[model samples]
Target: MLYALGDPVSLVLLLLSFVVAVTLHGWVQCLVASRSGLRGPAAEGRTRPDPRRHVDPFGAVSAAIAGIGWAKPVDPPDRRNRGALLRVLLSGAVANVVVGLGALALLPLLTSSVGSLVTFLGPSRLLQSGIEGDLAARALLFLGLANLMTGLLSLVPIPPLDGGRLLFGLAPRSPGWQKAEYQLDERNIGVAVLLALMLIPLGGPQALLPTILDTLAGPLVRLVTGA
Candidate 1:
C-alpha cells in the first residue's frame, strides 16, 4: 500500500504510519489479553508497544507488499480457557477500528493547516491527496487507513490470522472441525493458503484479499471522513 506512492516523502510517511499501525495492533492485543486476566503476555513483557516485540518479520513484508498484514500472534496465558479466546482474539481488530475512527474524529481538531477536508478523504485518495497537506495530518490519514485495513484483513477466515483461529476456537466440538483445525492449524496448510492469497495475483475478482480490502476499507474511510 505504501509502496505505490511515487513521492519519497509520502512513501516515508506511509512507511512510518504502517509500522506504527502494525505495532499498535499487536500491542493492543497484548494489552487486551492482560486486561482480560491473561498473565502470559504481561509475564513475557509483550505488553509494551515496541515494534521489535510485536511485528512479525514475514508479516511486515506482507504489509509492505499487500497492504494487509498481521502482527505476531498474542496467545493467552492459558490457551485452555476457551471462554477467554474470543476476547483475546477480537480485541486486536476492535483496537484498530477504534484507533482508526478515533484518528478521524480528531481530524477537525488539528490545526487548520492540515485538517482540511483533503485529510479526511480516506486512504484511496492518499496518493493524490495533494502534497500541500501537512505531513502530520497525512501521516494520521495513513495511520487511520492502514489500521482500518489491517483490522478488516486480519478477520479473513484463514489460518494463522487471528480471525481464523478465533472461528476455530468458537466452533462446536466436532470430529470434522477438529480434523480440519488439525490440518490447517497444526499442519500449516492454512498458512500456505494465506500466503498464496496475499502473494499471488490470481487475477480479476478472484484476486481475493485486495478485492476484499478495496471493497470494504473504502466505505469505512468515507463514512468516518464524511467524504
Candidate 2:
C-alpha cells in the first residue's frame, strides 16, 4: 500500500494516527470488559491504552491500506450474561465515535480547514498520504477520520464485526438462526470474506468497504466540524 504512496512523513503520520485510533478502540473494549466483570482483559493487562496490548499486526496493516480495520478481539468472560457481552461488543464502536468527535472539536483550534482536512482522505479514501497542514493539524485530522470510519465500519452487519455479533446475539433463538450463526462462527466465513473485501479490489460494490465507510462518515464530519 505504501508502495504507491509517498511522503515518508505523511505515511508515518498516517500509521501513527491509525495506531492511536486502533489502540483506543481496543483499549476501550478492554476497559469496559474488565469493568463489566470480564476477567480476561483485566487479568491480561489489556485494560490499558498500550498499543502492544491492542493492535493486531495484520489488522494494522489492513487499516494502513484500507482505512478500516479491527483490533484484537476480546475473549468473552462467558456466554452466561448476554447483556454484558453485548455491552462489551458495543463499547469499541462508541468509543471511536467519541474519539472522532473529540478530534473534531479540537481541529478548529489548530486549522481553519477542519472540514476539508479531516474529510479529504484521497485515492479511494483508503488512508492515502496526501495530508497537508501543520503536524498537530494533520494528526488530529487523520485521527478524527480514522476513528469515525472505524466506529461506523464496526457497525456494519457483517460477520465478526461488532454489529454482526450483536445481530447474532439478539437474534431469536430459533433452531434455524442458531444453527446458521453457529456455522458462520465455526467456519470463520465472515472474517475471510471481510478480509478479501478490504484487501482485494474485486471490482464490485462489495469490495469497496473503505469507500463506503468514507462516504458514510465524511459528510457527517464535514458538516459538524465545519459548523
Query: Best-fitting candidate, measured by TM-score?
Result: 2
Error of 2 at 29 (Å): 1.2
Model 1 lDDT, residue 165, Cα? 85
lDDT score for candidate 1 against the true structure: 0.70
lDDT of 1 by residue, 80-196 (tens): 677678777878888888887778666656534333343344343442222445777767767777777778877887766888888877777799998998898779798778767
Q: How many Å off is the CA of 112 in candidate 1?
A: 12
lDDT of each: 0.70, 0.72
The reply for model 2, stretches above 4 Å from the true place, is 1-5, 76-82, 117-126, 202-206
TM-score, one value per model: 0.80, 0.84
Which candidate wins on lDDT? Answer: 2
Candidate 2 positional error at 89, Å:
1.3
Model 1 lDDT at residue 6: 61
lDDT of 2: 0.72
